[model samples]
Target: MSQPIALSSEVPATCRACNVRHAGMCAVLTAAELATMARSARRTQHAPGEPLVVEDSKLTSYANVTDGVVKLSRVLRNGRQQVVGLQFAPDLLGRLFGRENLVNVEAASEVDLCRIPKDVLEQLVATNPVLKQRLLDQSLQDLDEARDWMVTLGRKDARQRVASLLLLVARRCGAPGIDDPDRVVFDLPLTRSDMADFLGLTIETVSRQISRLRHEGVVQVANHRHVVIPSLPRLETLAG
Candidate 1:
């Protein structure tokens, strides 16, 4: 007798192929639930610097980052913007069950997203305990990262701060693991200006630090945006 097909196999073709579906919050979803979600989830793309959410906007939908990076920023009272966070693929893109968005979300790189209606997602969350836990887990994980970054900003020197950011992007944005390869090459997700904003450095400072890293042979750049980490461990030591 033939074995029964796996439930994951029954997930819609589009969803079955999605990396996000296999990890993050979506991992809790059963095949039928994924099908229902996929029926309403719209795939969308954005170029670098495109805005995805405005601060204080009505929350009518939620998104899953299927590819590329997102920037989370907020406007200060003085009219300057501060980048508070970055989100990567397979991550949920906004606050859960919130009535209004608290921060602005923008594409940090060419991005692909799967958008689900707010009502639909909320309803699913209400019914699925596992899904709710998954969402909460991700939220808590983000909070932990934020706290760690506070230390990076407050205690670390400029070079360390920059290395921390590079290590962060490489780890989150699909670079090879240390166990798999000593080297990692990826498109740098944030521009120098954006990195300066995120890291609390001036653009020139950010440039100098990157150049310093290149000089040290810790990292290499090509065509401006591609970052090649010849040794992730060496970079991680600097991040500390």
Candidate 2:
């Protein structure tokens, strides 16, 4: 059960200024539709490790991430757990029209969410064909990404897997206006252990592969969580 914290009373202006507004769920909405959504929407913040939606629980709300990352995962009956996916800013959270959550969603870093009531979202989706199509498109994209990750885990070697993860994170989180495509800098949203979970490797193995990449000049580690890629093409070569 997640609760919304009201950050502002004016939602339309806030939505207009949002960095992801044009690209996120709000993009398909008209001004009037957006205004209607604003009435039931509020902003909420979650700290790292806070659970946004728990597995098997009833969902009460829907959200769009305005900032930070979220990790989607599931646990087995025997207590084994794996990181299934990572959701970046502008990604939608919560299953629309679903009765319960199948995976646990947690903040990988400090996160801000535009929280909308479940009933309001359902109503909007019911009446808006464009909104429905956008949601369908998002679902298909997610399916494709999941399949690609499955291939990475099933066939790619440890080094390739690590490199692929780096490229994925950089594309998702890197700052804009770097004149060169060869260089990229971004922070690792997940810890080493969490990386292991996501990559289907052990903590020790993840650390070793990261060290190997550093020594081979594939990447420069500014710190434990910060990574710099000197050549994007070089990294992609290693990923394959």
Candidate 3:
């Protein structure tokens, strides 16, 4: 895929892709520092279901999601897979302090990611106190997300699990007052199998639960990919 537009000192502006949006890092970055960091970045694209990194692969660079989503998962000895987390637009990947990879990462949709060389990114963060703090803060948030997923897997049923997942995706990408119009419209980026894997359900069960929701007029399938939730509170109860 084509690399993202180049950043030049002549322009003296940071490439927007380099800023960590989810953690709110951009506002604190001085103009010059943002530009400096931008020059060291490149962007690339991946098609749906493409593996960005595999378990135990050598760590070369870090990525910031520009568009689309990615899922992180691990395979068990018996060949079952468990999805540990999902990263949406503006999220970072490959932030390990001293490892290649512990899980596999794959694109859940057509994706664009801004890539930063590992050593250069480290240098940039170490030299910039604000960026360093921001990275630390992001790490903490990620830890919390992981913990929440454990609860979803251990405590929630198929319906509740699906509900939780939907709420999460909506909150991440949904607009303000998502329920104001009595419909929450968003894309269901993951396939049924992917959803099943992530939620610890069988594909048949996932399909059944989704069908049940649609049959009950709880959600409307706008297309093969888009979903419209007619009642946010009802969905919340289903998820809980």
The lDDT values for all models are 0.88, 0.86, 0.76
lDDT against true structure, model 2: 0.86
Better model by TM-score: candidate 1 vs candidate 2: 1
Write the residue-wise lDDT of candidate 2 on 124-174 in tens digits: 899878788888888898899899999999999999999989888888887
Model 3, runs deviating above 4 Å: 1-24, 176-182
Model 1 global lDDT (CA atoms, 0 to 1): 0.88
Measured against the true structure, the TM-scores of the candidates, in listed sequence, are 0.93, 0.91, 0.85
Error of 3 at 49 (Å): 0.9
Cα lDDT of candidate 3 equals 0.76
TM-score ranking from best candidate downward? 1, 2, 3
Error of 2 at 97 (Å): 1.5
- Give the Cα error of residue 49 in candidate 2, in Å: 1.3
User: Over 4 Å off in model 1, which ranges?
Assistant: 1-9, 177-180
The per-candidate count of clashes, in order, stands at: 0, 0, 0
